[model samples]
Target: MQTSPPDPDDLALFRDFVAGTRPLEQDKIAPVVKRSKQKRPAATSNSSTAEKLFFFSDEFEVFAETQGTLSYVQNGDDPHLAGRLRRGELEPQVVLDLHGMTAQQAKTELAGLLNYCEQQQLNCACVVHGKGLGILARKVPNWLIQHPNVRAFHTAPRSWGKHGALLLLLKINQSTEQQFRELTRR
Candidate 1:
């Protein structure tokens, strides 16, 4: 039996095969390389929807009810917000008492109040849409359902006002919010 050292050509051929320069004879054993990249969650959902709700918004905030998180710039009554509030540079944060007004009146008042609040750059707001008297008398006002400015509103926390009122996450003018952002950054 003749035992000989391996040829240089065989070693080079093996290296080429390992590097994938030469195709494997066994087609089924060939390793698959994924050529395409994955689509982003937002993009896979749709481009139109992507613009509608992105990671952040100047006018609106991303709120997760389950997680109880808010995306708005929080000044936290620190020196910045307190100073702005004192100088009338920022709008006050309070729950508007709309308890007794009829739905029609409430609707009109809502429009006016929202306009005023936004123009003044007020961020924190609460609307007291009281739970109907005694029994389940009526549904939430039709006007509230139709209002355009109301982005996201929900029942107040138990201590503040409960189901009788709602805490409105109001939208502010982009320019006014820019000031808030500046103050926050500073």
Candidate 2:
């Protein structure tokens, strides 16, 4: 007895069923994904103090509410600092640039500058520290960043010196100057 060959239509139908069960081609699946709706994350509510901006100084640290942490912090935090700097509260003083100065140099120079700013009752001063020579010199420039007399050493605005300089808000001894006058009179 001889077995009959399958029908042409049945053979075609079986081939199609086998192909369908096999892993789909990547290109075919990509188009299906493109047509599907993409679910996105919902926007988070603005609800925390850390999300707001913060400002601090040697003598004070003021926590203020702000819409964004990226805004101009100097003016937004305390108008007093900006006002005094603009009004020349410490202009009569001197500015010392310690760009290439070592840690020891910065320490020595800073002491002298602070004393001078205090004694002379001068205000506006510039301490220019070149953006570190290269990478490995991270904490070197930060010396001035922690000084007490440094009222606010922000990256200077366009009208002021640029990143290469720091505008100090010195805390001088008003009493010392007044005392000098009294001693001279006596």
Candidate 3:
């Protein structure tokens, strides 16, 4: 909001307008601000909030929503690690293509692949969601974001499926969780 300074011609009128009001007593009062920790759900194309431009933050950069892409990394993640993936330095051993598959089929296949990878301790994998205005391409990113095993995702390079594909970094916590359960077993 923008406002002009009081005009000399209107100063008398302004003073008369506020003649009945006294000055505020604000000598000792200070305001405290509280920041909310809640995170809003990722906006989609149909969402009303989708047009709001979300700016990048200092801690582990995110430029997806405003840039109209799906790439994201958890806050406090090692920048070098994220940079390695972004720079296409990391190659994924496991790559799954969801072309020609329906949404349900793709989810099931992705789940199976992710579960196998986690059980086998596979850290990096690639998923090709296919191109050309498909629903799977739109939905896959959101699915990847919500998956517990997924740590980060980045757009694949030209040779890898370009924007249609994503490189996923997974958190292999199955073994660690098992060991913890055994240690606390009674």
Each candidate's clash count: 0, 3, 0
Off by over 4 Å in 3: 1-69, 173-186
The alpha-carbon deviation from the true structure for residue 182 of candidate 1, after best TM-score superposition, in angstroms, is 6.8
Q: Over the stretch 1-186, how does candidate 2's per-residue lDDT look in tens digits? A: 998999999999989888847665667433453554877756534342212211112233231321111112233334456444443443424667766677555555665666677666765576555556521123323444445555554434434444555456555466764664474356
lDDT of 3 by residue, 1-186 (tens): 999998887999888898899888879857778777998767445332222112111132223342244566866665455565667776786999999998767766777678778777777788998875566676677667666667788888777877788888877676764653474353
TM-score versus the correct structure, for each prediction: 0.41, 0.41, 0.55
Instruction: State in Å the error of residue 186, model 2.
Output: 34
Whole-model alpha-carbon lDDT for candidate 1: 0.49
In candidate 3, clashing pairs total 0
CA lDDT scores, all candidates in order = 0.49, 0.48, 0.69
> Worst lDDT window (10 residues) for model 2?
63-72
Candidate 2 lDDT score at position 96: 75
Name the runs in model 1 displaced over 4 angstroms: 1-92, 134-142, 179-186
Better of 1 and 2 by lDDT: 1
